[model samples]
Target: MSDYIVEFNNVTKEYVRQVALQNISLKLPRGKLIGLVGPNGSGKSTILKLIAGLVRPSRGSVRVNGRQANRMLASEISYLSELDVLYPFYTVAETIDFNAGLFRNFDMAKAREMMSFMQLDPGKKVKDLSKGNRGRLKIILSLARQVPLILMDEPLSGLDPLVRDSIIQSLISYLDLEQQTVIMTTHEVTEVEPILDTVVAIQNGQLRGMAEVEEIRMTHGQSLVEWMKHNLA
Candidate 1:
């Protein structure tokens, strides 16, 4: 068995005239919380889509768990997009039940626990919830699943710092790092920095650098944001 859960072998993803990812290659190890950090339009989401089998690479190969990435990997991956995909007509509890029905590995106990942890009102309609609460629910939906890979795109987009803090705590508490690998893309670098084991920096549809989170602080005396700035410069 290989150590990597995801392998991108010189992958390139192009759409129309725009190239999202250009000849990128990296091996993402198993059982770690990784942050895919980059500026907007820097291909962060593209990477997650490829991993989730929502999109294919225009060139090279994308493999998840040694198999070619495809819709069949749905059982292996849980993807949370930046956009709102929740059924607004359903109540919070109903939405949880809906997701529980879709996947056998969906942990109902964990989902309820996270709903409570997120302070989401079960009886309230999804449309009635605040944006922050909706974001919390999205996190719960993705994290409650017992899967090898969790892909989150801009998970902390609109929330205030305090809410982000709680969400980050839940991310640490709920995940089993021995079994799961979380790849999250977020603009809130400073906020999510504490939970990340590794950081992969991408810019202008190309790989800029990759580094361990602790190494940057101990060796370079820099935060993830500072490291990104230096690399992107």
Candidate 2:
């Protein structure tokens, strides 16, 4: 079995004429929280989409759990999209049921726990949810699965500071890092710095650097936020 939960080998992604990622090669170690950090349009989300198999690379390969990314791999991976994936008409209960029916690894009890933790009403429809709640719902849905890998795009985006902090704390407490590898894309370097084990910095579709949080602090003598700014500057 591959030691890495996810791997990108010389990957390139394009949208029509625009190159989103180019000649990217990286491997994410199993069972850790990894932050993909960069500015807007820096290929951070593209990398997550590629690993989730939502998009195909124009070149090279994306592997999950030792297999090429595909529909089968979808069961082993959970993707929290930057955009809403929930149908507006679905009630919270129905939405959970719908997703629970799809992935065999899904745990309904865990889903309920997450909903309760997030203070989401089971009768509430997706359309009625606030931005923070919607984000929470997405996170709950993703974490409900007993998958080996998780990909999230901007998990902290457009949230109140208190709400963001709560979500982060819940993630740290709820996630079993020994069994799951979470790779998330975000611009909130400072907010996520505390939770991340590794940081992958990208700019203009190329890697700026990849380092452990400790490495940044010990070797570089800078916080992840400061190191990111300095590296990307």
Candidate 3:
């Protein structure tokens, strides 16, 4: 079995007028908190979509746990999209119940704990949620699933400072690094750099750099964001 949790081999993806990813290859090991960092339109989100089996690579292959990513792979991966895909009419409690009914791996205990950590109210309807609350709910739902891989596209986007802090803390609190790996995308690199084990930077749909967070700090004498600023300059 491959030791890597995620592997992309010579992958390229394109739309009609643009290429979102280009001849990219990456192998990420398990038991890590990886930060997918890049500017807008950098295809950071595309990587997560590929891993989640939501989009096909135009060329080559994407794999999770040595198996080709597909609909069945969804069973092993818990994906939290950048967009809020929950039913707006459903109360948070009902939404959690619905997901639990869908995935046997969904853990009600974990969901309730994370909800309390994020200060989410189970009785509140999704439609009444503020942007920050919606983001929190999305994360809570994903984290509740006991899966080997968790792919989050901009998990911190649209959140206020307080909620962001709470979410980060909850991630550290809830994740069992021995059993699972998390890959999250965000432009707010400075805020996330402290917890990241690795950082992958992409630009213009191509990989620019990737490395361990400490290697970056030791070699460049800067945080991931500062190194990105220097390199992206």
Candidate 4:
């Protein structure tokens, strides 16, 4: 049996009268490229935050590597948020070195290589770089971490077609599926469809569907984007 890296059991998260997640139960096994897809208000980011231990469930339990998600497991998981969170004054190399110092599992060499592959200058300050470069930097930093699980929230947002293609290629080339699992949330389903192993769709804080990408395509007889529009609309 595959070892489960993340398990959500009857999880419920609420913000006062609003329920962000409802009885969410999911078992994410190690080493799979899982895609989370849904509409704007579908709580996709919430799930990523929950797994990253940024938020706690109101009820039930969330486990990461068989331990409670709240505990410190910085070396085991790396989360790339939807928003850029780098220090504006820091240079790209400085940011990488800071993360390397903070996390024992961070690979400085891998980080440097990724920066070079992305054509991102190490000396460029975060504030001075273009949006695309910032996005690339975030991806590079997240990917350089030698962790078991990586969660990315909207990693491809706000990029041109060419840069998007480059980012996708870089992601695929850097990932080692045998040793790591990647969970990414994106509304750009068509661009990601080719590489996703599994798809998990959520609507209005509830799981709409979960299946292998091939199975979804076979059953619907359409691409993931077409299926998503047909189902989500």
Candidate 5:
């Protein structure tokens, strides 16, 4: 078995006239909570999409579990997009049931447990749920999956501090780090600093640096935010 769960080797991605990602290479270890932080349009989302195999790379390769990334690799990953794609007409319970039917790895028991933990109303339609509740539901859907990798794009975006705190707490409470690896992109640096095992900094479509969260504090006498500022500058 490979030590890394995901690897991007000299990869580049372009869209029409814009370069989304430059020559980039990365190796993400298994069973880690990795934070990807960068300015807006810094190729963070593109990196996640490439890992999910939602788009083909323009150069080099992306690999998951030592195999080249492709659409078929979707089975090994659960992606939480920044955009909300839930069915507004479906009640909370129905949405869970639908996903349970769709994904072979969907853990129905885990979904139910998370639902109760998030205090979501089973009978409430998705449209009626507040944005915070909706966000919670989205998280439950992603985390309940039994896939080895989970990619979250701006999962904390637009959420109030309280909601973000709950979500972060839920992440710590539910994740079996021995069995799953998570890569999350967020602008909430300080909020997520406590739970992150590693932090990767990206800028202008290029990887700036990657470091262990504890290493930053212990060795450099700096927080992730300080490290990110120095690297991204």
Candidate 6:
């Protein structure tokens, strides 16, 4: 009986005329780095939103740390989305301070350290920073939270190869597998393959596979990306 930090039980989400998710059920064990891979509009973001309590499921439930996903557990979970939603008027430091003040579990020191490592200018206003810097800032703020689970969606998108490498390195150094769980959704499967403990594949709003990374490689004799390409085809 492994302890689960996050659990989705037959969760479903629908938008007016379309079904975004269809009876999705999954359990995320504690302290594992899980990766979610799927094509666009496969309801990947919707699943993250449901877990973050940004949106409620149309049917079924999502639980975090043994409680219904809600604002009460905001301190226990940190979510970094694909979109950077910083206050345009605030400086990078100000944004971090705001998050720290809002979330009791936020670590200001960790945020500052991540900023320094990423070569981000804390004094620069959000509007003045480039897109890449904004993405890095979002990651720093999210990862710095002293939370049980961290959810990141498309963290590696919209960046050059060099910057992507730097982001990956920062994520690896910051992760503490003994205490924290990380769930990241990305199309850059190969980039994350080496670091992911488990991989969950989604297609057409349905779970295709969920298994340990090494077991997948052993059974398929191909990298996660290659396996995904064939299965997702």
Reference-based TM-score of each model: 0.99, 0.96, 0.97, 0.95, 0.99, 0.95
Segments in model 4 whose C-alpha atoms lie over 4 Å from true places: none
Residue 45 C-alpha lDDT in model 5: 97
lDDT of 3 at 138: 90
Q: Taking the tens digit of each residue's C-alpha lDDT, what string does model 3 give over 39-136?
A: 89999998999998888999999999988898789989999988779899999999989999999999999998888888889999999999999988
Regions more than 4 Å wrong, model 3: none
Per-prediction tally of clashes: 0, 0, 0, 0, 0, 0
Error of 5 at 203 (Å): 0.6
Query: Tens digit of lDDT per residue, candidate 5, span 1-233?
Result: 99899999999999999998999998999999999999999999999999999999999999999998888988889999999999999999999999999999999999999999888999999999999999999999999999999999999999999999999999998898999999999999999999999999999999999999999999999988899989998
lDDT (Cα, tens digit) per residue for candidate 2, span 1-233: 77888888999898997999989999989989999988899999989888878889999998888889976677788989898889999999999999999888999999998899888999999999999988888898998899888888998899999889878987897799989989999877788888899999999998889999988889888999888888799
Which residue pairs collide in model 4, if any?
A: none
Please list all clashing residue pairs in model 6, or write none if there are none.
none
Worst 10 residues of 4 by lDDT: 224-233
lDDT per model vs. reference = 0.94, 0.89, 0.90, 0.88, 0.95, 0.88
lDDT of 4 by residue, 1-233 (tens): 34888899999899877898899999887888999999887889989888888899999998988888973776688899988799999999998998899888898888888888999988989999998889999998899999989999999998888888889998899999999999999977899899998888888998777778898788867788876766676
Q: What order do candidates take by lDDT, descending?
A: 5, 1, 3, 2, 6, 4
Off by over 4 Å in 6: none
Model 2 TM-score? 0.96
Q: Model 2 misses residue 157 by how many Å?
A: 1.0
Q: What are the per-model C-alpha RMSD values against the true structure?
A: 0.7, 1.2, 1.1, 1.5, 0.6, 1.4
Report the lDDT tens digits of candidate 1 across residue range 88-205: 9999999999999999999999999999988899999999999999999999999999999999999999898888998999999999999999999989998889999999999999
- Model 6's alpha-carbon lDDT is 0.88
Q: What's the residue-level lDDT of 93 in candidate 2? A: 91
